[model samples]
Target: MSTSDFVETSYCLVFSNDKLRANIDTLLDRKGWRKEWEEYQGKLYLTVTAPFDLLAEEAERVKLEKKLNTQANSMARFHFSKFTHYRGYKNKMTFFSPAEQARLIWSALEDTPYSKNDFGRGVLPKFNDQFPFCTAMKSAPAFGLEDSYPLHSPWGKRRFNSNVSFRLVNLDHAVRDYFGEEVAFYFVWMLFFAKWLLIPGVLGLALYLFRPEGVTVDNSPYIPLYSLCVPIWGVFFVKFWKRHMNAVAFEWNAHDFEEEEELRPEFWGEKRISPVTGKIEVFFPEWKRYTRYFVSFLVMLPMLGIALGAMCLSLNLNNYIRDEESPLYIGTLAVFAQPGGIFAGDSPYYGYLVPTIAHSVVISILNTVYRSIAFRSTNFENHRTVEEWEKSFIVKRVIFEAFDCYLALFYIAFYRFDVVALRNELVGLFWGDELRRVGVEVIMPLLTMMFQRKRTTRKMRAEKKASNEKPIELSQAVLDAPLEEYDSFDDYLEMVIQFGYITLFASAFPLCSIISVGFVLVETMTDSLKLLYLYRRPRSRRAGGIGVWYSVMYFMVIASILTNCFILGFSSEQLMQWMPNMFKHEGGDQQFKLGYGRYVVGMVFTLEHILILLALVIEHFIPSCPRSVTTEMARRKHLAKQWLAEHEADASQQKTVQKTEHVE
Candidate 1:
């Protein structure tokens, strides 16, 4: 291949100093890595490429070891649109995506021993410690040209050939090609969710627009009906998502692709021979893990208390806004004086609006703070696998973030029985959080990139002056080096919280799904652009599905059923109006007088039990994998085994003939 082609397909490791470059170069060469070095702007850039033969060998080993699905043939190399193909037999050339090649290359590099110790450190960790100025170790595509024309070429320009499209499948392919299956799975699930959301989005819009006459939002019959339908929708949404995710996983050759989990490098424990692998591995005591869990819980309690304090402060401000006697009531009056009908002339909406804004802001800020703590706590727990650590982190996030996002809405809906405030709270939570996310995730990143670019450029010029070399433009690697590390946790958490808004309190505000649909579309595009342009290309990771997110949504689906049922029986005024006289007007204001207490409890439980049963039925009947996908997967496995048997038989016959000839 040409030099530019090799660079396009390789990973670039940029070093700020040359102290460990020679040792690193020798290690890479010994590990079968084909590398090229370029000195630019007084920095050393190493491009490491996996040789074709080595890549083919690694591909075969991975395919057999992991049982990765493949349909390999001579034509495989020619089809770019097909699921990626690899060399199935010896002396065959096959097309592997840059992502696939990167994985194989890294795996090879990771296997390089840095010491004679039994539990050896890899070249990467050893060199990171050895070279203080080593930086910018990322795939070439992070520094490669986009499809769009650019004015500069720090290296010879060769654009990555891929079209960006809004099509879910296409987007999944693009993301998987660049970022790997773990990140791609999230996008696929999100896009799939946004697509399915159209059903509820349209239904919610219709309910909002065509309610019966004299039906206020609180007393609207459509609200109860919509609330009931949403739980059922959530049930089927998750079931169908399971099928779709399975199909996608099958197509990607990763269906049920479970392997022995690798321990995180940070894990510390007594060394022991692993029962599963019979290999020397670190093992932490289970009792100590539990102790750490308890300690983490204790630390988290104070933070949760802080979250509760913020919520109470917001609620107090809300009550103050409504109570004209308070001194802060003057500020509330100013808010009521606003021109819009929703805000003008002592409107009740104004009471919830200002407080909800403050609540959302505090929740967002608190989430940022709690996230750091959550990470530290998860790390402290010292989970063995990355998956285990992530699961622990996800559970912690769900607990804190759910309280931060949903507790107030629950208070308004169940305790206060104020549908108006609940709807307003939903609107504020939805939009306020969205606005905050856009600022933090997208806008702020762009501004930071601009500032960092200027600062780095000046620093590079200063270095050039010290060397007395010609002035050179800063490279793409240098630009991306200062950007924040990309992770999908934040994006996944945001989606889960939004899912709660649309599903849990969907009855309170029917437009939630529609608004979220639009937001999701915009989010998909913005996230794609963010990953492509604004952040470093994250390392490739394997994943079979969306992982812990699926479980979170499953629980949320059940919670939606319970929440909606309570809203219908306890908070819904129109439902009460339709009920028998025996249950109506049991000594409360019109807004709160939904029913007699005992009957309402019975009714709520009855509906909740039925919905819960229905959800179970839906989950039971709908298979996780589609029949077609399962059949195709079976065919691939059958063919793989058949091919293996034939090869073995042929080799055996050849050995027999050679032995007979030698005896003669």
Candidate 2:
């Protein structure tokens, strides 16, 4: 929990061969090696001081308590490492090491603080023990070798090999092993660069170029070179990562999908009312009918939060804003965003910033947290299909996201002290009370809907069976169709832009947003109220899609840019005193001058930062999407299921003939 706990608790042990002990002593004498050595089973092993000893020991004890086999316990039993997966700063005092990942399961059996008995069954109750711990050494010799064996104990190799359970292996000799010595060297090098080179390197050059105390002025030559290559380093990292994912999918044969996408509970409690007529009426249960509506309502929650914050800002600005003469700025941060934006005082853009930032950050956190919760229990037994894999992703994350976003609006509404005369006690009483009820009442049903959406699919199959139409079994039908191909620019627009935007939460004014009254307020309330009485539970989309968070920055960049221009271009009564500082502190004339150091940072922040954001948005606007790999697999799987059914029927018929022959 604290730095002291991490440092004080010694976990690792060190031992070596009698011959090696002296060598090690000489090697590590300067490196702060403490504690004594021990001999076991005629082997001189150095019990190096490691943090993972406690984890490994605890994991083993839990395994014995659960009565789980050695293998299972080993996979689950674990401890953390001193080094971090990321770079540029000191490693966290505690973090996961691959060696300890396997022992984590056994740790669970011991009723450890981190143990969760109900992982896959509830939100994520099932824990799998198949992932190997092979990546402990980045420069693993066992990697890419058929007969190569691990040198460290089995636990030491669990980190990288854990992905081996996912079956992502690269056997190609043309490219070097991903974790080979050279690759490892590069990996460390890049991390060091990411931490130190990118941000600090750029800053150093700027400081040197625009030094208040003149040292050397060589900023111009390296400017383009630095700007260009930093991105190149980033690009190589991205490509390398893609290969990493592909390798995992290949090794595990996980590319094949397991579950069809569905609204599982949508057709629950269906009724056939028409007996005499050829057409039969099926009544959808309450939640099934309003699936889209419910999803749309949830989608609009952030907007509702925005509206709430805006109103409070407006009210505050109405009374507090004393400035006059608005500036002509570009986007969300113009005069409209201030306290007065909602009323007559400031521009309307003032109230939008905080909610925008909050929304983006919340979405990112929700995207990652629930996904990990879902991912915690994956193993060979449970990870048979893509749906199972995504189960953790959808169920765990959606619930948390619903609660977090729901509460955001609640906080703003509760704290907005717009009352003319407020008794301190009753200023804001019931901000998120209704949302808290909704979160409790509806979350379970929504989560259940994820696994049980087949209610409708089965209902439809039954109807087809009874009627003249041939029955289309859902298991066979869902994966039977292929995605339509894209054609021209019109098709691209139709498929990617309009189709993508409307169905997903696409922004109307990306460069400049203006969610005005009338529909916005109505939608906000409609969305909020809908959270209570949903017809169907919606599946989780890529809630933390790069598009959404990037848009926030895009919004901020535009806002900041507009704010800069407003201050620089216009002579506002309020900001004129501050605006003078952005440029060099001018003489009596009060104008910007060339050759000043202020130009270095102020120029880059206002000019380069804005351009970078805009360019990134433009690059992202090409409208790409995941390949329809899931669609293809579903179709193939449907055909496979149908084939299997035919085979089983034929086998049954053959058995009957054999029995008849025997009787004769």
Candidate 3:
């Protein structure tokens, strides 16, 4: 608490102009901190001194204040930790005093200075210099605060308070302001899907009520209606979301953010003089870049082929296991039954369950390998920006992920959901992927928490032993090491894949919406926790929109329509039975045709085309950008032109006055 015990910390505050610097100075002066200033490396460094006890106490209090406000805004009960309670007790009498505690509370509630700027047009302020202040509590070495000094939520470490309700409008603005448009776009994309997930829930309820009891492939009257509506719903949702996201981007000044041309830090090249600028720069040959691209394709194609082949094999094995007549199934059953097939015939569920579990394990391993290779491949390509790298990586990932759903749908549609024959034709597609998706959402967060706790406990033990002999200060790395790091991209990808499952295959599995709803509800909280506490803040990458993910979603929408058509037309025995046998050919001894008749094939093709055409028409009519945004842009343009004209006229008048003075 004495001056000798106090730590002096220096922070560099960068400002574009003196006005902004003065504003910061005034704000700091008001807080009653003793400070001195120095100029270093074209930046102003403000040095402040405070007792260690006071700084730590103040930092803890500020953290609690943020938590309480977030909880209040979210309409949730405050989660009280010991630090929060301690702060509460300390401020009990001071809280009512307007001069001290009120100002602190008000400051916490105020919007960040940058939040007030007009996108691309107004003065933008930033914490340009890296300074270890209150914001740097976790990383600042001088503080020596324990990694777990401020207790996080019982749920986990979070970037934001998860207990509160998330308002899309607020989140959109805040993320756009803080992290830039690229990150915000992903957030919006996930939220859009999360919000519309309710529609399917409602649809599911309606279907449940109207659907006939004991409905099978032969008896369901609502199959065609469900098929038609589900696809149309997907199309509309995409169209609506496109318009909504565009409006948000325009508002955030992210709609036109140009990608910077600077090379990424990871890019490697020899330093040389630039021909155009006459400046030294690192340069990589264009031909080498192209060669890397070719090599990447060569590497990825074989991996992709293997994955596809494995997927087919897995699907086939799954279907084969389900059939009692298949040799593979009989052989497996006999192996178990050599001990009298203990409970083999009694439990039919295990037949499908065993293969499904194996299939899940195979796919999981393949996915992990593919993702690792894809990331390395992208890095090898040496893209100049994070956006380029992400887009390239996403492309590779989407192709493999989409294959899982598309292959499943293809088999179900053309092969008439006959597992035995389809298993032989190519592998069989099953709904087990849905279970895998749900399991991942439920299990990953818990695993994250478990790992984090183990790390924290180890650190605590190490600290206790160190303290027993001699006092030691916590290093920045040690402070940060125990915390989990997360990237928004992975979270967004997970949610998008989940959305694809519900949108594309919901007709085949009505309960998909229910599962998705549950996953998303949990995901919302876990993601918030991860962002707020578990991870280091990611670098802000400005984005015009959701980039490749938008295309991915569109692909899902189209895929959904086609999938439902197949399910209704080819998979439904009732629909197939109604088709005429005019084009159906009779084979030697077989009474049924090997495949659909020409007439039925024609009907399926016609239905698919008509649905596609309808979707196109709807999309065309639905504007991608809101009318209000267009009007606002026009108004701003007009005002800008008027101001320019007036300024020019004033300059001309000033020139005339100077000419008159010279003549005199």
Candidate 4:
């Protein structure tokens, strides 16, 4: 679809009351919003458009800001906003893409000021305040007014169809145009992640499949090799992703989009003269905010402790079941393995598998409960911006999620110092918990959609029979109304945790990367399916990059360095056994006391520092913007200068023409 068509046809607003409809219409007219009204099932629907004049004005404003900022050198004392002009700014007229148009329209709606006479002057009310309930007035009051949101276009659905081949090479434009940059960045990053997994996946698989015959876990040479490679892979993965993000961001006109952050409507504080803009605005004290954060941390620390305690309990229970020397294990076998017993010999339900299943269940349950607590705690911390709020929420949730997902594996690797058990734990978590997550995310949604369709069909048939009329086909809105909202946070979190598995413990389980690659490919199709058929169209949101998730991944990259080094140097028996004979024996003595341990620690220390330095070097040498992107940026700057010069000449000519006309 064309940019104009996508922008003008995608949005919808719904209201039911006649009086409220009139009020809404009045508001739309006053705001110069263009919309077509239609009535359906007792609801008044408005198919709204981003007004052409307003869009043009916005475009011009952006262009002018760009021009002024370009002229205002970086060394200037006064602060200037860096607004990225639309792609068409080189021409005299600028045109906004669908995503930009949608962003502008949403901003206009969100910034709609309430009447001082209707709402008190002291309280700043907004258009959203009219929803759910509206105060009565002489004209009309709008109640239960649904928020404006974008509709899933037919073109979008077709473009995002998962049934098509999984070649996602150039879908970034389509995704950005339809779902906006936030969702686009996610899909792009996901595809990029899957692509990057191929190198490590294949390498790990090769090492795992072709190990020497009769090689025990303690003597395999592949373990240290694979472990050494993974942390470097992780660091490169994050660095290269940063580069790719910049390239794609430049293409999508979002390279500097985050610089224009607006104050969040939910923010509340005492009014004061803002230092940034020198305007009267609400300001929250920084010290008070930090105090609140400290208090929230104190509260959540106990919860985290509880989570760790549960993990330890699960581990202990698993050991009890797995250990044949334990009385619990003997009793379990006695009950199940009795001659002619109901369970028979080695029954499918009775095995060491029970404890692993129980452990996964415990993790799932704790994750569910802690996610809610994390959200509430973050809200109590009272961040002032969406970015701050999201970063805080993500950090809080990820800490708990990482603990839930990896605490057992860490304990097994470091505390128990068991390589075989660590490998087993990785396998169990992958097949049991990880795949279960996929089923819940993808399969449950599919089943729910099928059920909804069946119920809708039955309802249609009953109506036809009652009225003695032909059956009516279901409309898009009706089909969509029953579906749930599609939020990407859970999907992002799940993938990041999976990433941790592959990178942090790749040596313990050589197949980790390849297994994750398979899951990621499946998720590609399933996520597309959810967007196209199983959920309501998500609201478009503007994002500069993957937001704070990149930071999360970078931290994971650093942690992976430490973890993998530890695994190779101390956790892996194979590597320790390979230590030099001199290092194994105490210096100037025959005793095998602290020599090996010290040597291993020294090696780990050296390896970690080298990797950390390598990461720093990569960060320095590999520019965030690729060469092509840098060239393109320079070209755009030149074009902006040309446009500004031409514009000035035209204005001067117009002034001169007016002067001559006055003289005549």
351-409 in candidate 3: lDDT tens per residue?
53454456556766777888899889999998855557777888877777656435544
lDDT of 3: 0.53
- Candidate 2: what lDDT? 0.30
Model 4 lDDT tens row, 1-664: 2334324434656665555455556665765776666555577656666655555555444432222334432111111111233233433212344455666566555545445344444332433243222221211233445545665556455644532455655566667766788888888898899989998989877775676888754467666777878888888899999999998877665676544554344566787787898867677899989998998888788778877776655555445234556433445434433444333323455444455556777777877888788888878877777678877887888888888889888888887666776876777777776667677877898898899889977886787789999888755555565678887888898889889888888788777788778778778767766776787777777677897899989999999999988877666565655554534433422232455657667878999999999989988998887898898778766766675566668778999999999999
Best by lDDT: 1
Model 2: residues with Cα > 4 Å off, grouped in runs: 1-240, 251-291, 298-303, 306-664
Give the clash count for each candidate. Answer: 0, 69, 14, 0
lDDT of 2 by residue, 87-197 (tens): 211432223232222233222222322222212223211221111111111112212111111112223223333333221122111011211221222222222222322
- RMSD for each model, in Å, please? 6.7, 26.1, 12.9, 6.9
Task: Estimate, for each residue in 1-664, the C-alpha lDDT of model 1 and write its tens digit.
Answer: 4432332345556655565566666666664666666565566666666666566555555552322235441111221111233343322222455566556655555555444132233323332322111221221122221111111112211112244544544777777766679888988988898999999999988876787887666666566778889989999999999999989988887776655565465666887888999867668999999999999999999999898777666655554235455433455434433455344425655544766776898898898899999999999999977679988998898899998888878877887787776776788778888998898889999898888888888888888899999889765555555666677888998998999888898788888898888899889878977876677766676788998789999999999998888878777574665664535454654433344667767877998999899988888888889998878777776776765665568778899999999999
lDDT score, candidate 1, position 184: 87
TM-score, every prediction: 0.82, 0.25, 0.63, 0.80
Give the least accurate 10-residue stretch of model 2, judged by summed lDDT: 504-513
TM-score order, best first, reads 1, 4, 3, 2
1 versus 2: better lDDT goes to: 1
